[model samples]
Target: MSPKPSRGTTRTTQYQGNPRRILVGITGGSGVIYGVRLLEVLQQKEKDGIETHLIISPAAAITIKAETDYSSRYVEKLATKVYRFGNIAAPLASGSFRFDSMIIVPTSMHTLGAIASGVSDNLIVRAAEVALKEKHRLILVPRETPLTLIHLQNMVRAAEAGAIILPAMPAFYEKPKSIDDIVDHLVGKILDLLEIENALFKRWEGLSYS
Candidate 1:
């Protein structure tokens, strides 16, 4: 967990000595914007030694086109490296590949179930499994609503295996004025899980009942 910053405190974007390698997996889910926004933020942190390795699922490619105006190629360019979804032979699929964390933004229920069941038929799931086996941070940002019992069970199973199931639910405490504000808040929460300091959204302060 990231230390809560005091109100009005400014965080420096100083470059840390060692490179922080993060593996990102985007799946086919409704809220594809979350994944895109995360990539944009990470791209901005490139100077801070944050290296992003991205893997976009096939279904996600379709979702990207359907949901956002940005091209899939543009999204791929944001990452330090990109991997194919079906390439299980990729370095990320191996437990030996050293990475700080793996985040699956907009994780589909299908992908969640696959990870929970220890099924690594694809590179994304394989990388997640490796993250678990290697004791690396694995954050799953599920975007589905009205989840079924199976979905909840899968989430529990994944959580038991050391994966953080962070849903794409934004808070209203900050009094968001636009959809971008809401998205930023959720992205900030995800950054907190990685212990990455950010001011993407205003932090909650004590209630002020004047």
Candidate 2:
């Protein structure tokens, strides 16, 4: 468990150079690997002064264990801090969590729907809601194969509410040479939206609306 923030005080990232803090959430979905990969990259960045806080849904925990054999505890270790699903009282559940942004990787449609509807049944939803209310960066990465109308509607709502609707869709425009390359490309897009410089993938060149 991460140390709770002191009441009525600003909680800051524990790094020199005042690195930015980001909140990453992993929900139950097919592309759970994206969340893990993002964590791996962010942890590496932590050594260079970047900090991260994370929240993992029970479904995400199970999916990681089943899909990748990554011990949930070890995966949780990647973050500067981790919060449980039901811990609505966690610092991030409030607008004062002092995070620069939040991203929900492999966001389950169910979770997305609840967030779109302003439902805060769990810390994941609550944290996202807080991010919305606080006008902080909020990104959602859904990996669904075929989105339904309801899913589209929910995504539209979240997008209209200042959340970045970044689906976990990777493109071959850069001609990825490997599977990891594709993953890195998608992560690179997320980092770009967050205004974080990343060397995850090559940027598109020679592309124009013309």
Candidate 3:
């Protein structure tokens, strides 16, 4: 088990300067599109020196094929670096391997429970553990509906341990016309958390009430 962080520990580094490194983990959740779109958006921001290190879980490969038209190889090409799910020896497993933040988009309930319990059985969870222990930003984008009490409790546990629980719920206040619009809104929210400027989706300009 990874060591827990102490209360009120400050972040080791900020997302300043060029070449901001971000670690992205895509699990087997149904909304793999969010993960893929995040990569696409980050790839577009490569000129801004946003470097992405990606990890695709074994189950995520199956989800990608079942959900999206793009091949897994194609998805890997969007990231600056890619690692296998089972590679515990990867540099990301170490807290010394510096990164600005870690985002696990479409975070599976199983993954949530594992991270909440500090069970680093695989590279993704290990990397997330490093983020938490190192006091770096860790964002989890859970995509399940009708969440069970256990699921909610795990989320609370992870949150208490310094993880940001960002769900995959899309808002209708934007009046999105297509699925891409909805996905972009959530991806844009992720970018907002990263403090990266983007206009992927329109911001909520207050409505006029007559």
Candidate 4:
């Protein structure tokens, strides 16, 4: 089988040392803006050796255009490269490709379920599975709501396989006043997981002076 359909421009104008080989997968999750914002932050962090390899499932393309001022064509330019999900033969589809990590910015339930069981039908799932088997960082930014038992079970399975199930749950501790704030907070958390340092939001460690 192949990954879901997608449409948008594919090319990037951002480049630097680009030492970071990061594969970013966008599923059909609701929080599409989070994925886009995450890319923007990472793009600006080019000095930190960040490079993005992107692949957005069909649904993600539609949702991102619907929910934000951005278009998939424009967003695609933020990354170093982009690939169709159908191309499982891509470099990222193997453990030897040597990526620093793979982040599913807005992982959908279906995609999450697929990864949980070690299914490698497409590049996103394969990249993640390879990351798991190779012991590289795999961060899942799940964006589902009112989770069902099935969702919980799948998350558990992925976690057991060394995938960090970091849902798109925003923190209120930053007292965010806008949607961008919320998205930025979640992106911040993701960067932290990728071991990239940033001051995307204020820390809420409670009365801390250090």
Output the number of the TM-score-best candidate: 3
Number of the top lDDT candidate: 3
lDDT of 4 by residue, 19-121 (tens): 7778899988898888888888889877767788999888889888778788899889988889998898898887678667788989999899999887789
Per-model TM-score on C-alpha atoms: 0.91, 0.87, 0.93, 0.88
lDDT order, best first, reads 3, 1, 2, 4
User: Model 3, range 49-154, lDDT digits (tens) per residue?
Assistant: 8899999998899999999998999999999999999999999999789788899998999899999999999999999999988888899999788999999989
Residue 9, model 1: lDDT of 13
Q: 3 or 4, which is superior by TM-score? A: 3
> Between the candidate structures 1 and 2, which one is better when assessed by lDDT?
1
lDDT of 2 by residue, 1-210 (tens): 533322211233343457788999999887788888898888988866777888899999889887886877887998999898999899888876677778899899989999989999999899888888877778899878788999998887887777888898889888889889988888888878776689899866787877
What is the alpha-carbon lDDT for the whole of candidate 4? 0.82
RMSD of model 2, in Å? 7.5
Which candidate model has the greater TM-score, 2 or 3? 3
Candidate 3 residues lying further than 4 Å off, grouped into runs, are: 1-18
Per-residue CA lDDT of model 1 for 23-112, tens digit only, reads 999999988888899999999999978989999999999999999998889999999999999999999999878788889999999999
| Clash pairs for candidate 2 | none
Report per-prediction Cα RMSD to one decimal: 6.3, 7.5, 3.3, 7.9
